[model samples]
Target: MENLPKKVRSKKLNTRVDLTAMVSVSFLLIIFFMVVGELSKPKIMDLSLPHNDDGRISCGPMREGENRSITVILDKNNRLIYYMGLLDSPIIAPKEIQYGKEGIRKELLSRKQNILGYSSRNLKPENIIVIIKPSKKSNFKNLVDILDEMAIAKIETYAIVPEFTPEEYKLLALK
Candidate 1:
């Protein structure tokens, strides 16, 4: 055995792995995905539905429009018909108003001003009440647009009335 060349022994390699870089890389990947997920999340609006925990609705008694209420009817073909107060007696007759600054926005602003002046003059505790009624032909976008208008108008009291009365059906039929 001594005559034979001494077998060269291979250097023992370290068995321990430096997990710091690997752990750091894994944490970076996790944080990157989390940030991307949050950024890609879809934005949405909140809708209020009238109902109770027991599955019973409590919308309260309907008010016979006292000229302080406005009913906005959303129909197909992007048609918006609005009137102040009940159909039987309206402060402002139902008319087709546009969407932008020259349309619904103008109407809402003017009407709000009128209501404020009238209430102040009469010394009545009243504010503009908006009732949104979306017909069957109307789309979700129409409802959303109206809701956005309501917000832009800074309307404090508004309700989405899903049900349409007989008079409303007739009015829509005429559209």
Candidate 2:
């Protein structure tokens, strides 16, 4: 067989992608989401906490250490009554003559601690969310006060809403 001289490869076809348009589109999407996310508030609705294996009331997110949703019920005595689940026992109750803030702070801290477990690590209180549920007759001022206290504790994701059944509720109920 006769050997022919090797020829250099021809110019590549369709090998280059013009990223400029794609980059522009990405930037537009980022800008759009930023505008919308900033304008809207995180949906804060009341939810039943759920139960643990021991039949104890579980509040917040079931995963532990992660942000937990909650229900804040205001009883007739102008007292703060909290139940962990749709049917769980009250995990927090306000002390007479004492503000409800203490109870809330304690509960938040406790849940935070419980979630940390034996990992020998913990997250800041800011990452944990407190879903505040005020009764229909609850004073708006009281709700504000509770929110204020939560803020003081560095809880930034606190939500204020009426009752709601989040997907997590059913997931937790089965547990």
Candidate 3:
């Protein structure tokens, strides 16, 4: 019996795990997510801003003539105040208006038509320039809405001015 090989007993362990399929699935999921993340980037609209670091552009000198500029002041609670020409001598006085097809949009269309008609008579070939002044109380959405309105109106020249004039502040405060 001593010459015969002895039968040894060993503990049975449940460590036989096949991880090849799991590893392959995890890699596939990771690659899929990576590709999806790369493809799902947000589309950004192009905004034309002044090159000045202070975010304010120099007005220089105000020309004395029939003004073809519109100043739209954005305030809190979606309040919009608009004035044509200079604040001192406005072609159209500052008035509060809405944003939709009936409010500022209508005003913009009428003003554009009137200006174009008058300019055509004078043979000056002038176009309206829009100056958008967003106040501290205004939000980003308001700015974007105004920009969309500009695009819908087909405005070619517009400027975003974050700095509010004292008169503009008073105008916003009054309402």
Candidate 4:
């Protein structure tokens, strides 16, 4: 009595890894870096400071011919020492100009057409007033190229007075 034959067992298979295409490729690389970080931003330039009620920091009294008022200064190498009114008495004598587009954009478009032709013969409406004076051997791209020539000479009255008096530092130390 000898009859032994019964043996058959083979089954082992378990391998599952399907993270939905790697979680949709990491959420599409975090929405493509948040839309390229908001389209690479950077473009600013809008300064407007000057408000002292009782501090007494006035920039007044310089009116006359065409209600005169210029005074540009920005000296040192790229020199552009303009003049017309007030710097403690400067009704024209600082002239030195130089810096692009036919130098200071043709002297700020001929002083904004001579202060808009003397404010249109006194009816007034274009009181051109620009006093930038950036000394300390001027730099910072000559105060951003004179504030981009006061916005390409459309100047709606300007004033960035950062101190320079002492007769404009002895007229920029006699140039």
Considering every candidate listed, which one attains the maximal lDDT?
Answer: 3
For residues 31-120, write the lDDT of model 1, one tens digit per residue.
Answer: 999999999999999874445557775576534335578889989999999998768877677788777778887888888777755442
Identify the superior model by lDDT, candidate 1 or candidate 3.
3
Q: Write the per-residue lDDT of candidate 3 for residues 7-45, one digit (tens) a residue.
A: 888989998999999999999999999999988988799
TM-score of 4: 0.30
lDDT per residue (tens digit) for residues 1-175 in model 2:
2687778899878878889999999999999999999889687898755566677886745454222444555433456654443333333322222245556667656665554342222544345556676656668777777777676666667677677455324333332
Candidates' C-alpha lDDT:
0.79, 0.56, 0.80, 0.73
Flag regions of model 3 displaced more than 4 Å.
Answer: 1-66, 117-126
- Highest TM-score model number: 3
Between candidates 3 and 4, the lDDT winner: 3
Q: Give me candidate 2's TM-score against the actual structure.
A: 0.43
What does each candidate score in C-alpha RMSD?
Answer: 9.2, 16.7, 9.9, 15.0
Off by over 4 Å in 2: 1-67, 85-102, 118-125, 164-175
Model 3 steric clash pairs: none
Q: Per-residue lDDT of 1-175 in model 4, one digit per residue for the tens?
A: 2677666676777778879999999999999999888787776898633334566544654244425578788877778888876655665566787877898778777766766554423423346778887887778898998888788777877888988767878888887
